[model samples]
Every structure is written in C-alpha cells, then in structure tokens.
Target chain A: MTVDTAPDTQSQIHWFLIGMRGLFSLPAIILMLSFVGFAAFTAEANIPVDQVMFMTGMVWALPAKVILVGSMLSGAHVATAFIAVTLSSVRMMPMVAALIPEIRDRRTPTWLLLIISHFVAITAWVFAMEKVRDVPRYGRVAFFAGFGITLTVTNIILVGLVYGAVSSFPPIVSGCLFFLTPVYFLTSIWISARHRVIYWALGIGLALGYLFAVIAPEYDILLAGIIGGTLAWWGEKRLRQKEAGQ
Target chain B: MSFDGVWPYIYIAIAGWLATDIWRWAGVIAGKRIDENYETLNWVRAVATALVAAVIAKLIFFPTGALENSPLWLRLGSILFGALCFFIGGRFRQPLGIAAAIAFLAAGLALIGL
Candidate 1:
C-alpha cells in the first residue's frame, strides 16, 4: 500500500541537509547578523525598509541606501532616486574589475555572474578580496554562492523582524546597527593599510571628506573620494620618488 | 491586492537589482582577459577602498536617525573605543573577534545612556 515516492523523498532529504549545513555554521550566522543588523538599522532610520531590503538582497553597497533614502526624503522624483542610487553604485565597476580576475573560470557560466552579483555587498566584497586568493577559479563561484545564499536569507529574516517589530525595538539598538557599517569599514582599512602612503592618504582623505561633508552636504562623498584619492596618489608618487632618489 | 498599487515599488526593486547586476556581468566577461596586477586595476582598488573609508567616516561623524540624536562626542568616543578593540583583537589575529568587540562597544555605550 506504500506510495512510490523515492525521488520526492530523496529531494526532501537533500534540501533538509542543505538547510542544516547553512544554519549550523557560526560564520554564516555572524555574517547574516551583520547584514541584517545594518539593513534593519537603515530601515529604522527612515529609509524605505522594503526597498532597502530588496536592494541589500540585490546589490553590494549599503551606502547606496544613503542615496535611496536621501533622494526620497528630499522629495526627489522616483526616477531621480533611482538615478542617484545607481550613480552611487557606479563605484562597483572598479570593485568588480579588481575581484573578478581572482575568481573567474573558463567553465563558469555567464548567468552565474548575475547570481553572484546579488551577493556582492561591502562585507562579501571585502572578504572575497582578502580571502578568495587561494580558492581555485572554479570554486570561487561556489564559495560566493554559498556565502550569498546565507546573506540573502539573513536579509529577508531581518527585514521581517524590523517590519514586524518596528515599534518594540529601541532606537539605540537601531543606532547600534547603524554603527556596524562604519565599524566594519574602518576595521577593514586598519587591517589592510600596508603602505605608509596609504595610511596617510586614508587619514587625510577621511579628515578632509568629513570636513567637506559638514560644509557641503550633498557632494561630500564624491568630492572627498575624488579629491582625497587624487591627492594621496600624488603624495605617494612623490614620496616614492624622493625615497628612490635618496 | 491590486497589481497596479504595488507595481512601481516592485519595478524599482527589480530595476535596481538589474542595474547593479550589469557591472557584475561585465566583470565576469572582462575578468578573463584582464591582468590582476595591472596598474589601472591597482589604482581602482585603492580608490574603491578609500571611497569606502570616506563613507564610513561620514556615517559616523554626520550620522542621521537615532545616531544624530546622540551626543557628537559619544558617537566619536564609541568609534574610537571600537577601533581600539579592533587593534587589540587583531593582536590575536581574530578579525571576527574585532568586529564583535566593536559591535559590543557600540551596544554597550548605547545601553549605558551614553
């Protein structure tokens, strides 16, 4: 009287295993919390929670939330908000260029790029650049897929929590979540600062950018990144030549 | 319930996703031919990293939302303490530990009414 269902049973078992593997990993959970925490914080800060949730799931930069939220709050047209957010993300061009060579494979399908692109956040990008060096080209996509799946699930859960529990959560908890974005970036910079010139450049760039942002709210990031980066590059070249001459 | 009611938001979401995905696809296509050590690539990495750093500084110092309500010194002080935690945690070569410590310091400061 038993039903013939071996394939269905096996598929269920396989999915169960996959779910267990993803759920049990500590790093996966931590990475998930970092993503959710920041996204939820951004939502509480008056950004369009759903749009940001969707964007965090889709794109790599949470800072793009700045543009999305800012443009909307300022009563910009939806078209303008989209344009501003898209423009902010133009920086990803260099990020992808730098990271792809480390992870590309001849056998990798072109479509997988679209999938992996979803996992391309500040956290994933920084981690991949730092740790994906030794991973074989074929495995890089798998690694990121696994990591991306973890992030995607995390974002969905956190969005639900924030949306459902928006009133109950303390403002400071949200503030703490916002704090993680900056903390993560600064720590990464500290760990990766290899050259003296880089250190000085980052210091000057941050200082000047902060000052400029205080004075001129709208164009601060663009002004600082372009101007500060240019000045630092020039300063480093000059310093290198001076050392070489001596 | 009506499709028209939610269509614009949905459209924006999908469009945002697609726009960013375009660059990733380009990366995959171009990555095979590009040299990693190219000077231009290195320069791009430097600029990207610096830009991210600038964004971090801006968020902390000139924050919006609940953070804007907190005192300026408290925000800066918590970040400094977090940076210190990062250095000390790095002494153990634990990046995760440093990140957790930074998160903990911020939460702790907030809980203490700072």
Candidate 2:
C-alpha cells in the first residue's frame, strides 16, 4: 500500500488503491475526528446509535446530518427538516458539478457517476478535486470511489463506536468532543473562503442566526441563511458596480 | 406523528438522504451543461456558506445536546479564541486553531467545575 508506482497499468483497481491510500491523509483524519464529535452529539441528543450510523452513511454530509439531528431535537416538523437539509446540502451541487466533468469522459457511465456523486461532500470533494487532475480519466471514478467508500465506512464505524463509548465518558470529555465540530467548521470555512463576500456572508449569517433563533427558532437557520447570504451577494454586486463606475 | 424508535430513521431517510442526494443527482445531470465558474455559482456558494455558518452558529449558541452543559461564555469564548489563533497563526494553522479550541473548551469546562 505504501508503494506509488507509475501508471504503467491504468487499471481501475490500481487507481482505486491509490485513492484508498488517502485513508491516512490529513483531511481524512480530521474528518474522522469531526465524526467523533458528531457521534458524541447524537448520543447526547439521545438518538439511537444505529440511527446515527445510518444517518452518517446515508446523509453523508456533516452539515446536513447536523441539521437533521438539530431539527429532530428541536422538534421541528419533518417538512421543515427536509427543507433545511435540502438547503444545506445544496453546497454539494457545485462540488459535484465541478468534479464530475473532470473525472468523467465518454467512457464513464451516468449511473457510475451518480454513485460517485454520493461521496462528494467537503473532504472528499476537496481531496478528489485536488488529486483527480492527475488521475487518468478512466480511473478517476474508481479512485474517488475507493476513497469515498473507505472514508464513509470508516466514519460510520467511528460514529458507532464513539456513540456507544461516549456514554461512559465524563461530561468534560463529552463537552470537548462537542466542542470539536463547531471549531472545525468555523476555521475550515474561514480558511477555505474564496472571496470577500463569503466573510460578509459568514458574519451576517452568524448575527442573523442569533436573532432568528430568538424570534423564530425553528426557522432560524433557513431565514438567516437566505436573508444573510442574499444580502452579502447583493452587497458584493453593488460594490463591484460602484468600483466599475469609479 | 410519533417520536419513537425507527420513525426517526424513516424521516432521516427521506429528509436527510433524499434531500441531500437530490443536489448531487442534479449536479451530475447538470455537470456537462454548466460551467463550474458560471456567475450564479457565486451566489450559490454564498448561500451555501451562509447556511453552513448558520449551522455553526446554532451549534455554538443554541446546542441541544451535551454541549449545552457548558456555559455560554465557554462556548462563545473558545470559538473566538480559536478564530483568533487561526488568524494569528496564518495559513496552515487550522490544526493549531482546532487544538487551541479543544484545549480552551476542556480547560474552561474543568475550571468551571464541570
């Protein structure tokens, strides 16, 4: 597994092996740590561990999983949960759209691409997008699938173990576990922010989230996100126009 | 209409799995048609970022689980401290920032007699 031979043979399995090697990558390790946090969260929320495992593999995205659990705990209606998860998961669209073409060519099947798309959340997306360019077109899907399947299965097992183990842990331990996730997201989002507008969106979203939680707790995430994001985008557009005029 | 065993899984399947996967399905369908750098993609990115930020805010300010055990100050302070570290340490310090946050939280929880 430690060997990195050249692509004399472009077998899908060879590329898949290369992808599986990312199991030890920094992003994968960080993701596992985050899932440990998520597992602790689900345990604290009193969600069944099996269900947490299910959601981990099925929902796939951390944010969407959090929203689902949050919505459930907050007693939001099912429809509301659906909508929030949908909105949160919309981020995957651009990632999938961007990566599919890079990895796919005339030989790739739509069904296979669809299967691969399930693994296109943040960590895998970042990893695949960064590495796929080096992969031959025929093997990119296998490479991504190898990484994706390994990552997902590893996380599902991690969450299950953590959820079961968190019960015996002290409050301080669980508290620290809970603390890892938000910090991870905040720093990662800040670091990965591509443009100035994202900062505006983040600030506005945080501020408006607090306000909406007070006024309309169930809809806080939705309302704050739409209004704040729109405002940020609109502000950026206006600023660009003003600069153009000047 | 119930909040019992297995029901939540069903809801999650529909609301969580279906809701999330639809976007990926759409992306695969639309991948060939749209440029990744299309202008509207920026707005989509903004909204997505905002949504994720909103989720983070909710987790910090109004968590429902064991995280609620800690005081609001600890929750708020640790995040601020982490962000501070992130900025000061420059790029490639995300691990440092996260480690700082976990330490802050653990120390805060211990000091407060949790």
Candidate 3:
C-alpha cells in the first residue's frame, strides 16, 4: 500500500485560521494604535495620506515609515529620504534572518517564502516567533503568513480611518498620538528582550545616540548604530568567551 | 527632488522596493542555505537591535514637530513613567506603557495650552 502523505486542504485552512487570530491579538492592537497615530502625523504634517498607504503596504517596517514621513515633511529630497529610510530598515535583514529559520521548511513553497519575507517586522515577527513554536512545523509558515498579512490589512484600514478623521481631533491629541509610535517601539524593545546583553547594548546605544544627536544630528542614527552596536557586539563576545572559559 | 509629479511614485516604488525588499530577499535566500545558528547572524541582530535603540533615542532627544516643541523634562518624565508601568505588571505591559507615555505627553500638551 502506498503512503498518502499530503497537506490536506482542511488542515491547512484550520491552521491558517489559527494564525489569522493574530489580527486581534495584543500586539496587533498596539500596532493599530501606532498606525492610527501615524495617520494623524501625516495628516497634520501635510504629508500625503496616500504615501502612508504606500509605506504601510510596501514598506512594512515602522521605523522606516516614520523616517520617510518625517524626512519628507522636512523637505528632504526623495533620494535623501529613500537613503535614510533604507538605512534604518537595514535591521530588517537581520530580523528576517532570525525569523525565517523558525518557519522555513522543505514543504514551504519558494513563492510563499518570498511573499512571507515581506511580512516580517518586529511586531508580527516577535508575535509569530512566540506562537510558531506551538504550531506543527509544516504549518508554521502558513500560520505566520495568516497572522502577518491580516495584521497588515488591519493596520492599513486603521490608517485610512484615522487619516480621514484626523482633522476632527484636536492638535494636542494628534501630537500625543504621534508620540505613541516611538514609545510603542521603545517599550517593545524592553519587553521583548530576553537577555542582559541586549539591555547593556541598548543603554550604550541610547547614550551614544544622544551624544551624536547633539554633535551631528544629521548622522546621529548612523553613528550611534555603528558605534553602539560594535560595542555591544564586543560585550556579547566577551560574555560568551567568559562563559566558554568557565 | 520634491514629490512633484508621477515620477515620485515611480521613484518610491523602485528605489524603496530595492532598498527594503533587497534585505528581505537576502534573508530568504540565505535562510535557505545557512543554519539558523550562524554566528554572523548574531552580528546582524546586534546591529538591528542598536539601530532601533538609536531610532528611539533620536525620537526622544532630537525630536521634531510637535514633539520638538515639548519640554525636555516632560519627555523624559513620560518615558520614565511608561517604563515604570511596563515593569509593574505582566499582562498588558506594552499597551500600558504606551498608554502611560501618551497620557504623560497629552498632559504636557494640555499644560502648554495645546
């Protein structure tokens, strides 16, 4: 008798639905608040709402979107904005590297893998990473796809709603909402971390980043990342060496 | 140049896609070939971590627009309070921290007469 082994349609659908539940998960809610705030920022700053939509869908990275919108609002050329946004999002490559390992398998199609790569971000990536461990290995990619894609759609809708209603909200409220984006990312950084090394790195990075901001605001982000990350990397290495030596 | 015509969208689509998606595709191709535990990947993660750290610090210290107008102590106070909320409880910590930060800033806005 031949063994009939295939991904049954119902089972796949079942797992996909399980993943789709991420749309309303805690992280998703936080992301929605940030997106709504982003819409308000764009509305108030005279940034075209359509660009927000474009960044929401095409560039799923939040920090990049923030940089893009902020730079453009400051009258930076499109090329300069692109460079800053791109450099900021370079982190996503490592993010994807960390996440792809959790879901990739022989059964996951190449096309699916390509498409799902677009969905990786700090919010969805961390949430999916935590949840993927619970899913059957074969279905994990599908699960991430379901969770991530739905979250994006939800964010896009929230952006539209908030942008349309932004004029009604007081300028103070819009200002408060804008602050939420950075705080959301900042809070998540502290919350999601699992080690002291990261804390040390972030501490040094923040200090160095602030110093650089005072000295050379134009290259603050770049200099802080390189100098601080290199130091953190050195710290992590020393820790590892110590552990191995002991 | 300024976003003056249809060329802006075209530029965004092409340059933005290449800028962001290139790394993603690199991850896809590399993930297929390398072990998840590759050491160099750690360097990548560390860099990513520090990048976010820098971005957040920039927002707090070198802010622009509405954020720029706010008093420095107010911003620091907001983050401090938000961190306090995050560590105070387990569930809803992220949202709670976020809410605290927003409320703190909102209060600042009110004090300054919006």
Local accuracy by lDDT, each model = 0.61, 0.79, 0.74
Q: Which one wins on TM-score? A: 3
Residues A1-246, model 3: lDDT tens digits? 111246678767877889999887767877787677677767876656676677788887776777766766676776777787777666676667666777876677767888889988778866865677777777787788889888888787778777878656776765776677668777666766665656776787788888988998777767777778778878888888899999
What are the candidates' individual DockQ scores?
0.42, 0.57, 0.52
Error of 1 at A94 (Å): 1.6
Model 2 lDDT tens row, A135-169: 76777778999999999999998888778776567
Tens digits of lDDT, candidate 3, B21-98: 887888777666654565665665566667667777887876755666778898899999998988895887887888
Estimate, for each residue in A1-246, the C-alpha lDDT of model 1 and write its tens digit: 122322244443444344335444433444555555555555555555565566566554567755555554566666666667765665566567666766655555667675666566666676666555544444566666665576566666676565545544566665765666676666665655555545665676688768878887666766666667667767777778899999
The CAPRI quality class of candidate 1 comes to acceptable
Ranking by DockQ: 2, 3, 1
* Number of clashes found in candidate 2: 0
Candidate 1, residues B30-85, lDDT tens digits: the string is 55456555545545555656666677678778876667767777777776666666
Model 2: share of real contacts kept: 0.73
Clashing pairs in model 2, backbone N/Cα/C closer than 3 A: none
What TM-score number comes out for model 3?
0.84
